[model samples]
Target: MSIEVGSKVQGKVTGITNFGAFVELPEGSTGLVHISEVADNYVKDINEHLKVGDQVEVKVINVEKDGKIGLSIKKAKETQQPQRPRHNGPRNNRNDQRNQNKTESFEQKMNRFLKDSEDRLSSLKRNTESKRGGRGARRG
Candidate 1:
């Protein structure tokens, strides 16, 4: 059977490695399910998740020109939760615009940054001069 990108297919795990697991697709074809693509969460060990001869359903993410196939187990499974609707009507947009208006403009932000830096530098210089009390003075 010919495998196409974005197609969900069942395959058998033929081999396991540190990086990923090798799966045998239909018609004697094989693909690599990368460690990241194995699950939705962090996958520390491939052996813990898959073993030799285990059947898994994977989504064909990419088919390289060199005949290498990329598969994703996470994408194959559908999410159980219903999606939330977006609240982006005119009323919500007015609130967003009000929030944006509260932010400082480029020149205003630069002036604030310069003033803070000048204060910090003056304070540092005073502290340094007070601590030195005469750089080359003899301790005696």
Candidate 2:
């Protein structure tokens, strides 16, 4: 059977790696499930979530022209919660800014970052100067 993108299929884990796990799909085809796509949360170690000979349902994310199939285990499982709409465009309107606090423009974000960095630098200088006996300490 040919594997298509966005289709869920059952497969057996044939091997495991630091980055991902290899699964043998139908018709003897093998696909790789990346470490990040193995679970919903952060997956530091793939071995903690999967092992050899384990059967898992994975969704085919991509079928490359080079015969490489990218699979995702998390996408195969159904979620009851509604997905939030992604904001890909620039948030220039008032409604977009009001809806999300992170919708600041490039200049606004740069100003905020500069102010925070200056504050941190001043605080660090104050602490370090006091520890080193201030500016006019006598050398004995």
Candidate 3:
């Protein structure tokens, strides 16, 4: 069977590498499931998720003119589930802070940054000096 973009197909994992896993689709065609595409979360190691001869359902994300195919196991799984609501997590809070910063004048932002930097530097110096028995302590 010919592989087409956006098609979900069943394939056997033929090989695994640091970057991705190669799957043998029907008719002996091979495609790569990139490490990032293997899962919704971070995939540090492909071996932990797949092994040779494992059967997997993959979505064909792209097909290059040179016969290379890009597949995603996560996309295939996503199709079966309803869309998830985004969490108002730390990332969103940081984005809100960034939006607030955008409204501030350049000079104001620079002054705030400088003040914060000076505070941090002074605190670091105090900690280091205390650890070394204060600046005037004689070394023995």
Candidate 4:
């Protein structure tokens, strides 16, 4: 029951901690299934996915020189699903939107810029005045 990187092995969950689940491998060696490696989705708690004595199939992702074995339950399951090919449809639409944005009239862009600047300056003035006791009423 030799465990090597990239190999899948069946193990029993020996312990569950806040950070990860410890699994006892077939050869009596234990490996850590970090919280991130427990699932494809966000796992706030490892206990939600595994418990002590539960059987799990984990993939050996790393074998550290200090004898630490890193495992991933997610990677073992991911092997069953085929990756989808990326499509260019949404990317082409984004390019079209960029071109449309570039076509805005100079006057329209200038107006928008002026409005944004005015809003920012007013906000800055309000913040500064509040801290300075309305600008004129200074503390003794």
- The TM-score values for the models, in the order shown, are 0.58, 0.63, 0.65, 0.61
Better of 1 and 2 by TM-score: 2
lDDT of model 2 at residue 6? 87
Q: Give the Cα lDDT of each candidate.
A: 0.85, 0.87, 0.91, 0.88
Ordering by lDDT: 3, 4, 2, 1
lDDT for 98 (candidate 2): 54
Task: Please report the TM-score between candidate 4 and the true structure.
Answer: 0.61
Q: Which 10 residues in a row give candidate 4 its minimum summed lDDT?
A: 83-92
Q: Answer with 2 or 3, whichever has the higher lDDT.
A: 3
Among these predictions, the greatest TM-score belongs to 3
Spell out the clash pairs found in candidate 3.
none
Q: Where does candidate 2 have its weakest 10-residue lDDT segment? A: 86-95
Task: Report the C-alpha lDDT of model 3 over 22-53, residue by residue, as the tens digit.
Answer: 99999889999999999877899888999999
> On residues 1-140, what C-alpha lDDT tens digit does candidate 2 reach at each position?
57999888999999999999999999999999999999877899899999999999999999999999999998887453455654545643534655575777888878867997999899998888877988855567
Candidate 3 vs candidate 4: the lDDT winner is 3
Question: Would you list the clashing residue pairs of candidate 1?
Answer: none
TM-score ranking from best candidate downward: 3, 2, 4, 1
TM-score: the better of candidates 3 and 4: 3
Better of 1 and 4 by lDDT: 4
Q: What is the lDDT of residue 30 in candidate 2?
A: 98
